[model samples]
Target: MEGLEQWKIQAEQWSQQALQYIHQIPPNQLYAALAVLLFPIIFIFFVRLFKRTKSNTIILSGLSGSGKTVLFYQLRDGSSHQGTVTSMEPNEGTFVLHSEETKNGKKKPIHLVDVPGHSRLRPKLEEFLPQAAGVIFVVDALEFLPNCRAASEYLYDLLTNASVVKKKIPVLLLCNKTDKVTAHTKEFIRKQLEKEIDKLRASRSAISAADISSDFTLGVPGEAFSFTQCPNKVTVAEASGLTGEIFQVEQFIREHVKP
Candidate 1:
């Protein structure tokens, strides 16, 4: 009878010990599980918030002597002369503008990028273009029909080839050195560009039609903006008549760059 009683007592003790051991859990393990569940949620919330608040980037690209540098300086300082072209190669820069709109009764800040205007550095320009929300193509008004024509053609081809640009990037054209050409009105410049753009569109359409018939690959259509004739001329050198064209370019950007 004593042995039976002792065995019962031992069994009860073992049962109690087993229950305590099973109930005991480490605090560190609980904390680790909580962290694993909550960390991704917190991280995702911040990432979405950042995406909502981020500003868009704009790229300004063209050929040498296209007033890109002048525009950059003018946009940054509010005034600059259309000096001799300093950008023989590709370059990158930024400008900031304060914008106010009645969107949920709040104002916002907008950021812009100014790029060099060199034909040889087109590959570099393409690299930055994908991030651009808009593009500003600056042309020297005095050379619009002659030397500027080449630049215009280059711009069209570049935009058409870029996959990102194929989706209708807002483009603004700034006609610099307008003060030098007495006979050239804003309308004249617009008409000239419109004609050129139409020709390019017609050619591209024909090529696409042919490609379809021949079962060959066709490229993106060339796109150009409805010409906005801006007379951006300021005298950079008193004797050279290289006026400050950058301010005019900036004004155009401020008016046209979409949020």
Candidate 2:
């Protein structure tokens, strides 16, 4: 009818006007306009991929009496401060390492945090993990056999955390207290931890979903568990916080936190 024909003519006129406007623009301008529109999207993607925020923070974690606080004191001042009292809140500091102080303030300052090992306080670990450059998991080498299962359970939780796993945050399984003559070797401790975590993996799997705690499963299914199986870089090192033999821990910190 007459009304339908008139509406079609107006639509055709609008389409022709748009085509003419586009045709009037230069090809170079069109390309530049398109690029300007896409610039924010490309920049956002690159930011997520490259992680522009490189952190100087390092985290020390372990069960009570694994010498985490002692190591923190040693790294900051090269002394134990006559032993540490139990810290309900995290002990945090930003300072240049004591060993590198001889360089006359040349080295970069580290943002070190010692998360309390108490189960009630362990949840505080995640607050600093987002900005952590590395994680050092202290183990009591002198009491390895007695604490192996508990240590593995704690470490297993760390390994399965979404941030730790997805960010591929490097972990140092530090066997501390090697100053003791009866201290277990790092190799022995590593193997025992792997065995204990393997057992934990199986046991955790059998639990109901509602009772599960870890966010991710450790190691491949039907496979024996090992540090090598972790998505992140996992290394073992020996240290003696009491005797001031923590060279490896310092080296790991320096490697991760650049000057």
Candidate 3:
């Protein structure tokens, strides 16, 4: 009992000393120190709460003949094999990017799907969209102008899909096959698609169906359409599967899918 009393007395003395030291500091300085200590804790809590699981599936979609298959083969094998055949079925695979493979060993693989541009097979995309880490919408830059409206329509439908909007799925408007000198620039294609979508938005709104399944909408109300208005991130990049100039496409994939 005596030894316990002695230890308690020592603890009280040390506690008093610590309190004296804390009280000696200015109130403002104490508050500043407490805030500095708390900031990281608060920041970490929010990050954990908001951070989503890293999805491994990356979707590659676009109109037929936009070279989605070529890009897929290029990503998987680092080659176009000098030709391609359109598959009406979804070309799905999980493999490490051939571009990232090194002398040491294979890098992390991704679930990539080349959904046929044909309307009949495009529905297969829904099966994977919920798990998609990112989506690459390939555009045939060489024939952009001729297919601009169709491309825009397809893109609009995609952006408005509930899966994409609710999950804030990032979409890369990848302009492919840029090796051809006559191919359009990414900037030109983005603008044309935006303008086309704006017109479609107005026309679609006029014929209101009470049963119209509402998904996400495009652009600001009463304002011109642009990618910035999207709730999800939308970006445009250029690539050429023919010449293997696909750095930006690979970058986009790694940015969202990792490794």
Candidate 4:
């Protein structure tokens, strides 16, 4: 009888231990399950938030003799210089551009990047171009006739080969040094660009027709070719040889890229 009583007490203790173990399992499993499931959800939420918050970048590119540096400084601090190149590295100085744009009646700030124009620094430019929401191509207006062909060729290649910038990137062409005598007017520059575009079309036609050995000598019809003016926010002005035109360039950028 005594032995039976002792056995009963031992059985009660074992049952209590079993109950405690079972209770512990559920809470531990609940936490473990939450950890496994909630991790991915939290990660995705943060990733989306970061992507939404990312700032847009704008890249400036042009020839060595072009006023890329002068314009960059002017755009940044209203400082102007003639016949000089910017020797700074990427991300240097107060390169951040802030502006206000009405989006659903709310204003936002946008970031812009001023890229180097040297051919040797092209790789660096390529890296930044993909991130740019737009591009500004500066041309020396006074040297347009003499340098138009080369400038256009370089511009075409840069615009065509860059997979990221080719299709959707908006490009603005600024005819610099317009304040000088003999500097082509905006209309004249547009006309010259139109002619170059026609030449490019003709070249493409010839290349395409050559594939089947067809008549590749067909000329591009002048009527079929049209000049679509890059959306102009400001008039071209003389940037060098006297008088400051930096403010004009800054105003144009401000008009387009509202941050």
Winning candidate number (TM-score): 2
Candidate number of the best lDDT: 2
Tens digit per residue, CA lDDT, model 2, 161-187:
988989999999999999999999999
* Cα lDDT computed for each candidate against the true fold: 0.54, 0.93, 0.90, 0.59
Query: If scored against the real structure, what TM-score would every candidate get?
Result: 0.55, 0.84, 0.78, 0.59
- Candidate 1, 1-259: lDDT as tens digits: 9999999999999999977865675778767877999999999999998877332565766666756666565555544554545665554544354222333543333355555555566666666666655676666666656764676466556545444335445665566666674524556665676667556556656664645322121232444433332122111111112444344444445454443
Assess the local accuracy of residue 86 in candidate 4 as a C-alpha lDDT between 0 and 100.
Answer: 61
- Cα displacement (Å) at residue 154, model 3: 0.5
Give lDDT tens digits, candidate 4, residues 1-259: 9999999999999999988876778787978977999999999999998877433565667676677767665555555556565645553343443222222454444455656666666567667666565666778787788888777655655545443333445666677777888888877876676678667656666665546322122223555444332221213333542354555455555555564
Pairs that collide in candidate 2 are none
For model 3, residues 45-138, the per-residue Cα lDDT tens digits are: 9999889567789999999999999889899998886667778889989998887777476467898999899978878988989888899999
Q: Count the backbone clashes (under 3 Å) in each candidate.
A: 9, 0, 0, 5
RMSD of each: 12.1, 4.8, 7.2, 11.2
Better of 1 and 4 by lDDT: 4
lDDT score for candidate 1 against the true structure? 0.54
Q: Assess the local accuracy of residue 140 in candidate 3 as a C-alpha lDDT between 0 and 100.
A: 99
Could you give me the TM-score of model 4 versus the true structure? 0.59
Note the residue pairs that clash in candidate 3: none
Q: On a 0 to 1 TM-score scale, where does candidate 1 land against the true structure?
A: 0.55
